[model samples]
Target: MTSSGFEALLEAVRGPASVNVLVITGAGISLASGIPTFRGTDPGAVWSNEVMEKGTHAFFQRAPHESWKMYLQRFELARAAKPNAAHRALVAWEAWQEAQGRGFAVVTQNVDSLHEDAGSRQLVKVHGSLRLARCSAQGCELGAPRGTVPMASVDFSAFHASPSPETVPRCPRCDSRLRPHVLWFDENYTEHDTYEIERTLILARQSRVIVFVGTSFSVGVTELVYRRGRKLDARMFSIDPSNASLDRGIEPVTARAEEALPELVRVLQS
Candidate 1:
């Protein structure tokens, strides 16, 4: 389809009539805001296997302090970063859709919490969020509430060279070590019983329009969502500079999210 044709399609979805829409976003959406993809070529930082290992459940169990240090660095980066045009566009689009009585939800793989910061009310962070922390001891009551810690309060520099459990943040309710409230490498989403995964699947089946942004479908959850959406006959589109081929029906808009999403919002508004 031509560019104008695609815009026309988006315009149709943006009509006053209610429509179910699912938006899936990835790390690529935050690239303009200086967040690194960390996967594939052109990674912002060279994360050795050792560093990657630190993001696993087993690693966190074995070395809570070390794991916290690595995650704190990432949290600091995300905390310092600001939302870019794509994030803001989504916020506006969600509001506009809500105004029209449409069902709009965002299912994002990013843990940065940028979507939340951008004022997206109907959002699901599939990979959990870096802004929150929970007790490592599952039995602790603090795990139920999901503690929030300001990155500024933690001394990231202290744990740079060595693991310091004493300096590591702890749960307020129970003094147990606090772990980043993220889905670790070894953890299964289905087993965790989180609402994000279940809700994404439900939305994928019900959505009339599904938009994939800044993701290459390298991860299983994203790939599953795309395939399920296709099986359910949801109209699919992608916005990415890589031009990654996700499936048969996906209409590709070959550009970065920052460049493409704002224009998409504008076209929809028009």
Candidate 2:
């Protein structure tokens, strides 16, 4: 791991009056979490290309049990992964800012709650969380919080025993199929989620500086943070080894988040 550009950018952004908000993206931050990279040159992703292309909607339509199995596998991996140095640094930064009468916001694209585990005060989980499950029954309003333990108890081998088979998870309340409470690829983002994001964006705009940590800013929702931050006239910094498809006007800091964030924290603390 090398030094991060975000750290250097953070140094420039720290000031007396203006609030500092940090919007984190996917891939770059999760590198320490042991999750496989999707876009880059990695070839050994556990899921097939069809699964990657289709996501939950396609899988659930075909084989619901298999979909659940795949989801659980990923969930198990994320659950085992602990919060890295970068995550702890952000949490510390947030604490420091809040203590000094400033604000700090952490908006993450990754569904894993590593930031939450690190005790981050302000967070926006844009992709939704895998640690929860919702009822699949039509007009179902109740959501069941299925954490790591419930998910691990699922008998995936028994569920995928037949061809054209669908495994419907029992809802704790209504006994309907338990749907993973993640925002699928084709589904529209929930209005509630959008509202929270919009509020965070407004807060970010008010900040004097915005940092894009451990993200490439490639995808739609993730990229919007960078675009909006730039529009607000806030100084921007990105930390990634690769700057592929970076939009104009944002400074690219070619480095990993783990190395960069701790160093940045040290500088800020000193």
Candidate 3:
């Protein structure tokens, strides 16, 4: 996108009439922060066949300790990484929009809580979060409110190298094995209301402007947002280096999100 087009987007967002802004984010937004993308055939792709098999609900149910070990390693990476410029820029934009009496919401596909760490208040994590863990038992009291334990507290060392069912961490409330609170590959979005996919869809339907940052638009939720935005005649913008095959109305800013977003925020603030 051109500088003038970006300026126009900023102006539209900054307008006085309470514009509703929707920011959709994916794994690419966190790449600059040293997080790897899960899919694609690139050297950086983190999702191998083994990784995909291990990330499923079936695998977790069959081998709880092994699942925990895999996720603990992944969560450790997210814990060590900090939010990048793109994340900070979105936080600033959200603050500015709120100050202007506009509505703003973030719908993120990323499991990493970088957006929350960067101070994005109005946000939803559709894929769930790696920061939390809950009991695996169905009838346990810990299942209702879903008491989440911090990943830091869990001693993953015991399960390292080789994991068995006996090595898995047990829930304090029911002695059932604990699992990562993230949505698994075998789970359907419609089956679980806990991840707040409905809330994201509502935001997509209401948004006047939708910004898709660092996404490949491969997932169902991202495609849902795209279709909804097109139907609502919402102004769409994409920040990506690759030529993402997006629909016509989307203004493509052919740059990395970390590069494009900071400039976009600067213009919005100015």
Candidate 4:
């Protein structure tokens, strides 16, 4: 927990009394909360790798009912999960930084609301949120941030295995099938959100140091955060259980994010 490396990195940035944005990605941070990463092997999934690769687009085209059921099944899983220690650490860091006339802008590739649930401010959810659903109909009357009757206040009971032959849910607004608002395999990201995320990365680059937590840094969106930090000559610290392909020439703290982040916050607070 006593990382002299993080201590030195903190000393370099704590002197500046301004917002210090921290860019992060999905994998390691959410593990403590029970969310699995791409390579992660959870007990088992309602949908397998094959189903996911086929995705909503393919399923809806060939088997509409099946796709809708899969979407609902995933939604229920996410709803049941709670925020974890790594998420709380980020929120605490932001609070402490704010007290010191500084702030944090967190841009994450996570679809889950763990960061928001952890009380982080100045957030950018680049991949959208799992809690939200929208009409699948293109340019349909249904819009962003879609709302619906509360699904029984989602809880532990909802994590049951998905029933076979997926059933589709409908949008009350337009009677169109409802779908998760998250980005999919064959889809492009939202331009507005992408621009805002890039803007935060630019700020993190100019920062004295950039801290990466739990991310593999394989995806372009997450990789850019580290790349920008390097461009600005910012000190870099990466926290993950294992080193990534992107770990070359960077200091790697080979530990889980849950273990590392709270410790980092404690040292940084001093």
Q: Pick by lDDT: which candidate is best?
A: 3
After superposition, the stretches of candidate 2 with alpha carbons farther than 4 Å from their true spots are 1-8, 42-48, 143-166, 191-195, 244-247
**lDDT of every predicted structure (CA atoms):** 0.75, 0.66, 0.80, 0.64
Pairing residues by index, what is the TM-score of model 3? 0.89
Q: What is the lDDT of candidate 4?
A: 0.64
User: Any runs in candidate 4 off by more than 4 Å, and if so which?
Assistant: 3-5, 41-48, 144-167, 191-208, 244-249
Candidate 4 per-residue lDDT, tens place, 126-227, comes to: 766667656677656554433422333332122335433234556676876666566665554542243255566666765665667776665566667766
- How much does each candidate deviate from the true structure in C-alpha RMSD? 3.2, 3.7, 2.5, 4.5
User: In angstroms, how far off is 134's CA in candidate 1?
Assistant: 0.4
Q: Mark the 10 consecutive residues where model 2 has the least summed lDDT.
A: 144-153
Which candidate tops TM-score?
A: 3
Worst 10 residues of 4 by lDDT: 149-158
List model 2 lDDT by residue over 1-270, tens digit each: 234455457656576656566666675687677876555444534334565655666667766666776677778888898999889988887877887788788877777878899998788876677776666655555442222124444444645565224446566656666666676776645533432567656666777777777654555565566667767777776777676666676677777778777777777777
Better by TM-score, candidate 4 or 1: 1
Alpha carbon deviation, residue 6, candidate 1 (Å): 4.4
Runs of candidate 1 with Cα error greater than 4 angstroms are 1-18, 43-52, 144-162, 190-195
Residue 145 of model 2 has an lDDT of 27
